[model samples]
Target: MQNGRKQIAVWDVFVRLFHWCLLAAVLISFYTTKTDGAPFLFPIEVHAQAGYIIIGLLIFRVIWGVLGPTYARFSTFVYGPKNTASYAKALLKRQEPRYASHNPLGGWMVVLLLLSLSFQAVSGLFLSDDIFFQGPLYGLLGRDVSGELASLHALNSDLLLILIGIHLVGIVVHALLGEHLVPAMVTGIKRFTSAPVDEKPAYRTKYRLLAIGAFLVAAGVCGWLWFYPY
Candidate 1:
């Protein structure tokens, strides 16, 4: 608490960990895929491993969205189409409200990012480059079908890159408007100019075991799926 404001814990430890871990995995996968085993000391297999890890992370995120803390839950932030449009209009006019959780536009952005990444990961499962690598599900489909899925995987990767650029731009815009979003994401605490009296205190971060269990389950599933075909 400082300067007539109050500090509230908005993100829990699991949420913060997921955010950073996903970011690192996505960046590593992107770099490895783009370079195609060149310019990096690590083998290209790291790229496929990163993609598998991302699938696990996505599974964890979906479960967390259902059972995680207040602000981390989808019900707490997702808004309807009309409400999102209104918020976008307000944002364009520089009159948007300060939300304790994710704002309407940001909430939808989160959904889009998740969906896009999910598509990319699922498609990657069927992709085969015919040389050095083959996805786990490649043999489950015909060559033609797998080839199409590989194309879709590449296309969606580009789309994800574009979405990532937009996400960064939004962060910069919010920062310029005096919102310290990055810090809040990092520290799990949000500082408000004047705390809302009606806002309930955040639930305690007591789901450490649940998060770890979910991660282990997700990792196990990924591992089995990756190796079972061989």
Candidate 2:
């Protein structure tokens, strides 16, 4: 603790690692799918692999949101509609209260982003380019249905870009409001200017093994789903 503030461990190692890995996977997926050629000698298969990675990460996150530490739990950040609206109003007035994890509006944004990504990844599994490339589960769904899902996947990709832009803007706003959110995510420590006297976040980084186990289980499921049809 320093400068009239206290530092609390908020994001755990698994959360931070998952966040950055997901970002990397998303970037790879976007580049491979959106461009004619990928950098770093990456092949088109990287796109599907990245989607698989995103699915695995999302699955692990869902489990972690239920069983992780206090600050990492969904209950800590996902607020009700009334509380979300109140937070939104305060945010517009630039007087929203500080939160150790995501703010109310940001929490909902996270949910939307997750849902969008899940759709994109799942739909891509049924896509076919009619060329050298075909998704793993392409034959499972008939051509007409898979073709329709491919179109929706492209549209959702655009929506994801919009959501990502808004997230970046929110990061900028947080920086202007004197909150270094990125660093906290990277370091797993959030500094509070004036923490509640009666309440302190409980440290629970000891669950690192549990986090790993969750990710392994998620990965195993995704692996079977990806390769079982082959």
Candidate 3:
């Protein structure tokens, strides 16, 4: 937590990059759906490109949530059922402790959102619009299987809307309570507390070359899956 412009790094560069990339990918994908069949450069490539980026970000995120900074790692926020229930109770009473990172309930929400988005990404690889935009992984499944996966993908995406709405509501509630959680994520700086909720420990930092390498390799795979069509 920062006190009067004190710098405490809560988010690594990789984390911030992944966050923005995923946001862009999701927005592009939704836009393409809204404007499907529009004629432009390549005439229908943006959604496919966006899907590849979404998957890449999701892969990077899963790896980072396991091995990133102290505040970013899963172990930092993932809590037991008791903690989640306690947080819920506190929220009802308007007394939930504000965490510099994710709170227990919010932590589970993060997990759920990640899992749901990942599932949607994977299923997207195997889904078609039932008309055009058939995925390259379409061959791995029979017609019936592809249809089922497409349905699952749509179902998951619909659920994501509800979850995101809930998250925005939570954010607004926190802001109303004078806790600027959204800025902490955007600026990677949390406001200070007298009782010290969690100490900001500066960990020796370096990007995992292997992760970046693997990401490039995944880009290769994405190309193969999108363009080369096995």
Candidate 4:
């Protein structure tokens, strides 16, 4: 249960909240999209609202990566492809080291998933089904452009599914190897074997302010997507 002599503040509370919120939003969106024929206003309204909520959570995540805790920042783990290859090789050899934060390969997966989902959200902003919700950007485009964007948006959703699969599999592998990676994300505590003993922790008050600001921006954007259309 313990790996080192010291405890490190790995992930913050807001980061965990955002992660779970995004997961819920994705599940709601999936259910609504998949069961459109069901006779229920709950699914209809919830799906539309959940889509916007997912976008909002993503906005918070991107902002948090820049201005949150040390382990929560992108700069802490976004390594180059070479580093990923080396990490991958180590992983294959069962020699990869556990990190208190995201390892290099895992870190880029975070970036890739976020970026791909960001594109999905951006495309969703312009998508309208004439069924449930009308995207604000729908009015600005002609039928052809709107149609093309809609198709891309539909196809891009599959990418999110694929990315989710990869992420889940990685977590499962870690679990099977006796590593509690998921709990680390949930509880923000991780065990690492080789860290030094007397490292000082730096505290920051700006992170709370940054997370709050991002959450507000996310709320505003999601509200606009739900209630307003151009």
Each candidate's clash count: 0, 0, 0, 0
lDDT for each residue of candidate 2 in 1-230, tens digit (9 for 90 to 100) = 88889887878888899899999999989888678644545456778788888989999999999888877778888899999999899889988888878888889999899999999998988987776558878978799999899899989999999999999999999899988989998998888887732234575658778888898988997787657554
- TM-score, predicted candidate 2 vs. hidden true structure: 0.92
Give the lDDT ranking, best first: 2, 1, 4, 3
What's the residue-level lDDT of 229 in candidate 1?
57
Clashing pairs in 1: none
Candidate 1 lDDT over 150-179, as tens digits, reads 788889888999999989999999899888
Off by over 4 Å in 4: 1-6, 36-39, 42-45, 196-206
- Predictions in order: lDDT: 0.83, 0.84, 0.73, 0.76
lDDT for model 2 comes to 0.84
Stretches of candidate 3 above 4 Å error?
1-7, 35-44, 208-214, 217-221
Better candidate by TM-score, 3 or 4: 4
RMSD of each: 2.0, 2.1, 2.7, 2.8
Candidate 2 or 3, higher TM-score?
2
In candidate 1, stretches whose alpha carbon ends up further than 4 angstroms from where it belongs are 36-42, 196-198, 225-229
TM-score of each: 0.92, 0.92, 0.85, 0.88
Give, for candidate 2, the lowest lDDT window spanning 10 residues: 196-205
Candidate 2: which pairs clash? none
